[model samples]
Target: MKFQDYKVTDINLADWGQKEINIAETEMPGLMALRKEYSSSQPLKGANIVGCLHMTIQTAVLIETLIALGASVRWSSCNIFSTQDHAAAAIASKNIPVFAWKGETEEEYNWCIEKTLSGSDTWAPNLMIDDGGDLTKIVHEKYPGLL
Candidate 1:
């Protein structure tokens, strides 16, 4: 999906979430080291990744690391209630596509998952990072051709 098509609860909270992400970056030494080590080599270069996880400050750090490693990414929350709006906003502010919000209904949750899976042929995700099996299950059920 295009970045403009991303569905987030609020874009206004980006600045606040960005501050939290900055703090989280400082606490995540291992991921930071990976960014430093692989940024030049770009091991994940040309990879497209879809991530389904809790959209929290910590997850933001992980997402940023993936970008640093040269992967393009789209993200959605694994749990409807686990999303942190500010964190989603922060990630989205960087032009990364994010499809999630706190307190989503079952329909909205599924919709977010679909958004993560939707993209142009050139932008389609080749890698998946799922904390829960929901995203995988959906892919298996609805887009078996991909599997």
Candidate 2:
């Protein structure tokens, strides 16, 4: 996804968030190993993934790992108040379209989920990873064609 399409709280925090992601990569050996094992095969090649979860440092690592395995991804935070802005920034910096921020209103939260579902004409997520089921609910209600 284009970097400009992302709607994160801050782009400036990317450096800090990237550092945290780097640290997390070291701590998450299993995911890292999976990346190393499958990157060449690209098992998820051409797959589009939409993820709704807490926007945290650990999640950043997971997002990057997904990319490494050859999936295109769009992400959103499950809870408006649970997003780590820096983590959002970092993921966005990598050109993974993200629609989330801290303190989002109800309307904003729904908007974010919509964005994740219909982010790009070239990429419509075939796989969903949702935490609180909001993403699933919205997709079912508004974009049943996807199911």
Candidate 3:
């Protein structure tokens, strides 16, 4: 999608992560089925989504599914240690604005979460998906107007 900004542990790991994402995709029936049914319809067209969850192979697959459904997204990890650099690489490789890595400090974790809320002037994220409450809390606390 050629996003203008993103942060990840390493772009070089994208190839390895893409392989993992490919494997995961094959195993996810529901998402694949949904993709097949909805890609052309693009029910999510013009939706802007921001997400905070564990960055993993599963998440990578889900991210792609969301894209296939036509939502533009920005994403981050909810927990510092829960991030998978390779998965982040895979997501970022698509030029999706993903901000995350493994083992972030408190500052970096917050920074990553904050980043997902940006591009508001351009993207205007209308949907938010978060594993823990952090992402949702941040939005309410710092970006109340978004609601």
Q: Which wins on lDDT, candidate 2 or candidate 3?
A: 3
lDDT of 3 at 103: 91
Q: In model 2, which regions exceed 4 Å deviation?
A: none
Question: Arrange candidates by lDDT, highest first: which order?
Answer: 3, 1, 2
Give the Å shift of residue 18 in candidate 2: 0.5
Lowest-sum lDDT 10-residue window in model 1: 1-10
- In candidate 3 the C-alpha lDDT for residue 106 amounts to 95
lDDT of each residue in 55-123, candidate 3, tens digit only: 998999999999999999999998899888999998998988999999999999999999999865767
Off by over 4 Å in 3: 1-4
Best of the two (1, 2) by lDDT: 1
Reference-based TM-score of each model? 0.95, 0.95, 0.95
RMSD of each: 1.7, 1.4, 1.6
Residue 39 displacement (Å), model 2: 0.8
Report the error of model 1 at residue 2, Å: 10
TM-score (C-alpha) between model 3 and the true structure: 0.95
Please report the TM-score between candidate 2 and the true structure.
0.95
